[model samples]
Target: MKAFNIEDTAMILIDHQVGTNTWASTTPLELLQRNVIILAKFAKGTGMPTVLTSSQETNVNVQGPLMPELQEILPEEFAARIKRQGVVNAWDDENFANACRNTGKKNFVMAGVTTDVCMVAPAISALEEGFNVKVVCDACGSTNQIAEEMSWRRMERAGIGLTSTNAIVAELVKNWASTAGAIAFPLLT
Candidate 1:
């Protein structure tokens, strides 16, 4: 496979609501939290443009914490590189889609809660649209191991690169000396 073109890459984070729950996971929720935070670190560290989306979060309160961290992570010195959208798929919402189109990227990087729906939907949509998509599997969780595995198989069939959060950091860093690599290694272990 050809190397990912980082400059043309965009990160899309879906439905990491503040109180979201994953029913079955070999990786604990805390680890999922840590992995996601580190994933954001990779995005900021690499200067990758990102789109953040949450669905029906108005009724639920599972989305929070990550926003403030991004500001500190990126330092926002190069203009805000992240956009928040009020959509489920993140690709289906017009604002999200427009934000993605505005990024001029061919690659979409993403992680989300409830891999069955939240993550799977946009990933499938993007893959169908001919976007080179990478779904960060480790950064997401499902109701159970069976669901997670099934979702993984579904994504794989779509020709999506189902990767881990650590792999995503590697994709962005491509070098250990980079700030992302330095920060990512400890958290992932």
Candidate 2:
């Protein structure tokens, strides 16, 4: 598999709201949580810029954990890379696309709720744009197991890479003594 470097990467977290926790069916809640946490921890430990967003958290039926690892691990003043439109697919959001353009980060590590839409959409978009996309499979949640599987299949066919949280972080680090290594190694285990 192709390995990614830290300087070439960015992390995007989508719609991990309180409501998602209550209704996600594409995967078990526990697996989703574990992957999301892994992405959050990896981003913070490596200093990768990350974008966190919700789809009307206040209005949606989905509910996410407070002080999510996304919030907790990141610097208190972390800025949003982008806040996307409430559309199921994030590629529809200009701001989000701009964020990716500005970062100059070729490798995109993405996780989101409603995997078929949020995850698949941007992944396909990024691939079309010639960006290296890695979807953190366990990190994104959906409405049911079938949907989750289908989303993954779609992205895979589109040339988006599939990775687990640990592998992605390890690829970014690429060495035991790298700066991210110092912080990420402890967190990985």
Candidate 3:
């Protein structure tokens, strides 16, 4: 409803792992990757508190490691990523949810590997917990279009705002001449 202030907003990226991403079909993989990278860069450049999580990453056959670019872009946050053991809803995992809580931010900007599963639950859960949440739509994908649309509707019904990478960048940056804008504007192109 209101603009996201950098001081009050935190980024939560869930299950953007290699294996899970391979199954994403709703959005093209290459575009998803690029959008996510842009988000990561914006978060890093803006000094936003970020929580990164993975589901069964060590079990490469399933969830594999998180996108390597995350490490390259936000190494410190990547190193502190929450590794959940097959938790479908990242919010269900105490550590992951706590990590988000610990950020002391009331607004969450989230994106994940699979829209239907990984993204929906956590977004709704956060909203239910009174957090203002906005899911980066283009930055998430699902097994199919049907699943993606269903998940989007579900989140919408639960009051979780759906947003896009470009929209978020614009919202956070606000003015190209400002400091954060100067840092984040280039990532859009």
The best candidate by lDDT is: 3
Model 1: per-residue Cα lDDT over 23-128, one tens digit each:
3264587778777778777676567887766566445445433434544554542133333444556667776677767778899888878788678888888878
Instruction: Please report, as a residue range, the 10-residue window in candidate 1 with the lowest summed lDDT.
Output: 76-85
Per-residue alpha-carbon lDDT of candidate 3 for residues 1-189, written as tens digits (9 for 90 to 100): 788988899999998998898788888899899999999999999999999999998898987999999999999999999999888999999999999999999999999989998999999999999999999999999998999999999999998888999998889888889999888878887
Choose 1 or 2, whichever is better by lDDT.
Answer: 2
The list of candidate 1 runs beyond 4 A from truth reads: 21-26, 61-88, 178-189
Judge candidate 1 at residue 54 and give its lDDT.
54
**Model 2's TM-score against the true structure:** 0.86
lDDT digits (tens) for residues 112-146 of candidate 2:
77787567887798789888888887777677778
Give me the candidate number with maximum TM-score: 3
Judge candidate 3 at residue 124 and give its lDDT: 94
**What TM-score would each prediction reach against the true structure?**
0.80, 0.86, 0.97
Candidate 3 residue pairs that clash? none
lDDT of 1: 0.70
Q: Per-residue lDDT for 55 in model 3? A: 91
